[model samples]
Target: MDVYYFTEFPYAEFPESEAEKFPSMRLTFPNTYFDPNKAHDLFKRYLDEYQHAEDVGFDGLMINEHHNTPSCMDVEVNITGGILARTTSKAKILMLGNMLPTSDNPPRLAEEIAMLDVISGGRIVSGFVRGIGIESWANNTNPVYNRERFEECHDLIIKAWTTPGPFRWEGKHYQYRAVNPWMLPIQKPHPPVWVPGTGSPETVEWAAKNRYTYAAFLTPLDVAQGLFARYREYAAADGWEAAPDNFAFMVCCHVNDTEEKAQEAGKAFLWRMNHPLRGPREYWSPPGYTSRAGAAAVAQRRPTPLNELSYEELQSRYHLVVGNPDSVTRQLRHIKDTLGVGALLLEAQGGPLSHHDTMRSLELMGREVIPALKD
Candidate 1:
C-alpha cells in the first residue's frame, strides 16, 4: 500500500477557547484571531515539513483547502500543489482538491490542475470534492445546487482535459461558448481522480461509476469497509471487479520512539476533533446540501461524533492511531487488510501538533512503520 503524508496545514496559533464565542469555528468564526506574522512562520514550517516527508520516504504528499477555518490554513490546494510539484521530485502530489461546486469556472480549474501536473512531471492525483455545507456558505453557493454544480463542473473539467477542446459546453450549472485552453495536463487522460467522503452513498456510487478511487476520510473502519463493499457492488454491476487501488482510507496517525510519548502527543488532535467540528446543524448540513438518504447514511455511519469520543475511544475505533513504530505499523496494516485499500492517507500533523512531534512522527513512520507495512 502507498503511504501518503498529509496535514491540514493548520493555523492554530490562537487559543482554542476563542471558538466558544462564535456559533462554530467555521463560517462565522471571526478572522480577527488570525495573525499574518504568525501564519507567515507557520507557512514556512509547514512547507518544510512537506518537503521532509518526501525526503524521508513517503510515496505521496496530500494537501487540502478550506476557507474560514483555522483548522486548515491552505485556502487553495492548487497553489500548494504547485509548490510541492517544484520542491519535491519523487512524491506524488495529491490535491484533495479543488472544490468543484463552489467554482464558477470549470475551464480555469482545469487549467490550474493541468499546470500543476505539467510542473510535477505527471505526478498529480486530482481529488475532487463536494465542499462541506460550511463551504457552500463561505462561497455563497446555493446548497440546493451543490450536487448539480459539482457534476457539471466535473464534466466540463474532464472534457477540457480529455477531448480536443474548442468545443462548446452548455449545462445547467456551467456554460461556455468556446472551451479551449492551452494548458493541458501532462498525464494522458488527465491526472488520476480521487474523491473523499465520510458516508455519502451517492458519492460512492458516483466514484465507482467513474472508476476513480474513493477515499474514506476519518470514518470508522467498519463504515469504510461497508462503503467499499458498496463500491464493489456498483463496479460488479458494471462488469468490472474493483481492486485495492480503487479505494483509500484516511486517518489521524502519529508515531514516536515510544508508545507513551506518541499517546501524549496524540492529544493535539483533540483540538481538531473538537472546536472546528462544533457547529450548528445548518452550518454543517444545510437543508438541501445532503439528500435524506445521504444524511441517514451519515448518521448511521457515525452515531457518535469524533469530538464526543475520548482519546481511548478514538484509538479503539481507528479514528486516530498513535504508537511506537511496531504498534502503529500493526494497526495500519490491520486497516489495510480489513478494508483492502490501496493507500493509507495519514494526517501526521493536526491542530497544535508541534513541529518537533510532527517531524519525529514522520521520521519514525518513514524509518520503521511504512516499510513494515509494505513487507
Candidate 2:
C-alpha cells in the first residue's frame, strides 16, 4: 500500500473547554479565539512538516480543506496544492479536495487543479467531496442543493479537463457560455479522481460507476469492509472486478521509538476527536443536508462518537494507531490485509502534536513503519 502523510493542520492553541459555548467549534464559533500571529507560525510549521514528510520518503502528501474550524487550518486545498507543487519534487499531491457544492466556478476549480498537476509534473490525485453539513452553514450554500451542485460541478470540471473547450455548459446548478482554459492537467484524461466518504451508499455507488477510487475515512474496519464490498458489487454489476487500487483508507497515525512515548505523544490526537467533533446535532446535521438513508447509515456505522472512545478503545477500533515502529507497522498491515486497499492515508499530525513529535513520527514512519508495510 502506498502510505500518504496527511495533517488537518490543526490549531489547538486555545482551551478545549471553550468549544462548549458554541453549537460546534465550526461555523458559529467566535473568531475571538483566533490569533493571527500564532496562526502565522502554525502555517509555516505545518508546511515545513509536509516538505519533511516527502523528504523522509512518504509516497504522497494529502491535504484537505475546511471552513470555520480549528480542526483544519487549510481553507483552500488548491492554495496549498500550488505551494506544494512548487516546493516538492516527488510525492503525489492528493487534494481530497475541492468542495464542489460550495464552489461557484467549476472552470476556475478545474484550472487551479490543472495548474497544480502541471506544476507537480503529473503527481496529482484530484478528489471530489460533498462538504459536510456544517460547510453548508459556513458557506451559506443551500443544504438542499448540496448533492445536485456537487454532481453538476463535477461534470463541468471533468469536461473542462477532458474536452477541448470553448464548449458551452448548461446544467441545473451552473451554466457557462464559453468554457475554455489554457491550463490542463499533465495526466491524460486529467489526474486520477478519488472520492471520500464515511460509507455513504450513494457516494460509493457514484465512485464505483465512474471507476474513481473510494477512500473510506475513519470508518471502522467492518464498516469499511461493507462499503468496499458494496463497491465491488457495483463493479461486478458492470462486469468488471474492482482492483485493490480502487480503494483507500484513512486514519490517525503516530509512531515513536517506543509504545510508551508514542502513547504520551499521541494524546495530542485526542483533542481532534473531541472538541471539533463535539457539538449539538443541529450544528452537525442541519435539515436536508443528509438523506434519511445516508444519515441512518452513518449513525449505525460507528458504535459511538469518536470523542467518547477511550484511547484503548480508539486503538482497538483502529481509529488511531500509536505505537513503536513494529507495532504500528503490524496494525497498519492488518488494515491493509483486511481491506485490500492500495493506499493508506495517515494523518500523522493532529491536534497539538508538537513539532518535535510530529517530525519524529514521520521520521520513524519513513525509516521503519512504511517499509514494513510495503513488504
Candidate 3:
C-alpha cells in the first residue's frame, strides 16, 4: 500500500506548569501562534521531509485545504501547487483538494489545476470536497445550498477542463460569458478525480457512480471499514468492479520501537485530540446541509450550541491508531483487507504533538510498518 503524510505544521510549545496560571486551551484558539516566518521555515522542513518520504519509496505526497482552524495551516493547497511545481519528479501530488463551490471564481481553480498539472509533468490526483461545517460561515456560503453548489461546480470545472472552450455557459450558481481556458491539463481527459469525506452517504454514492477514488478523513479504522464496504456495495450495484486501487482511507498514526514509547511520545497529542479547538457546536454544520435530509434532520444529528460537547468526547471519537509499528500494522492490515483500500493516507501530525515526535513516528512507519506490509 502507498503511504502519504498529513502535515498540520502546528505551533509547538509547552503549557504553563501551573494549571491556574494560564487559561484553559479552549476550542476557539487561533492555530498559528508561532511567528509567521518561523512557521514558513517549519513548512519548508515539512516539505523537505515529505520529499524524503518519496525517496524512501512512498507512492506519493498529499496536501489538503482548511481555513482559520488551528487544525492546519489554512490554504496549504496553494502551497501544494508550489511544491508540485518545484519538487522532485514522480510521486503523484494529490491536492485533496480545494473547496470549489465556495470559491467565487471556480474557473480560477480550473486554471490553477491545469497550471500545476503542466508544471508537475502530469502528476496530480485531484480530490474535491464540499468542505466542512465552519467553512460555511467563513466563506459566507449558505450551508443549505452546499450540495447543489458543489454538484454544479463539479460539472462546471470538468467542463472547463475538457471542453474546447470559448463559449458562453450559465448555471443556477455560476455564469460565464466567455468560457475560454488559456491552458489545458497535461493529463488526458483530466487528472484522476478523488473525493474525500467522512462517511457521508451522498458522497459515497456519488463517488461510486462516477468511479472516483474515495478517501475518508479523520475517522477511526473500524468505522472506515464499514464505510468502505458501503462504497463497494454501491459500486457493485452500479455494475462496476470494485478493486483495491479504487479506494483510500486516512489513519491518524504514529509508530515507534514499542507501544509504550510511542504512547509517551504522543500523549500530549492525545491530550490535544481530546481538546476541541473551536465550535459554534453541532459540527458547525448549517441546517439542511446534507443531501439525505433537510436542515432539521442535519441539525438534530449535529445539535446547536456545539460548544456543549466536551473535548474528551471528540477525542475518543476521532483519535485512533496511536501505538507501536506492530500494533499499527495489525490494525491497518485488518482495515485494508476489510475495506479493499488501495492506499492509506497516514496522518502523522495532529493536535499539539511535538514535531520531533511526528518525525520519529514517520521514520518508524516508513522503516518498520510500511516495509513489513510490502513484504
For candidate 1, the TM-score is: 0.99
lDDT of 1: 0.94
State every prediction's TM-score relative to the real structure.
Answer: 0.99, 0.99, 0.85
Model 2 per-residue lDDT at 114: 94
Candidate 3, residue 104: lDDT: 72
Arranged by lDDT, best first: 1, 2, 3
RMSD of each: 0.7, 0.9, 4.1
Candidate 3 lDDT for residue 233: 93
lDDT of each: 0.94, 0.93, 0.70
Better of 1 and 3 by TM-score: 1
Q: Which stretches in model 1 have alpha-carbon errors above 4 Å?
A: none
Model 1 lDDT per residue over 262-342, tens place? 999999998888888889999999989999999998998799988899989999999999999999999999999999999
Model 3 off-target regions past 4 Å? 12-34, 276-278, 291-319
Please give the range of 10 consecutive residues that has the lowest summed lDDT in model 3. Answer: 16-25
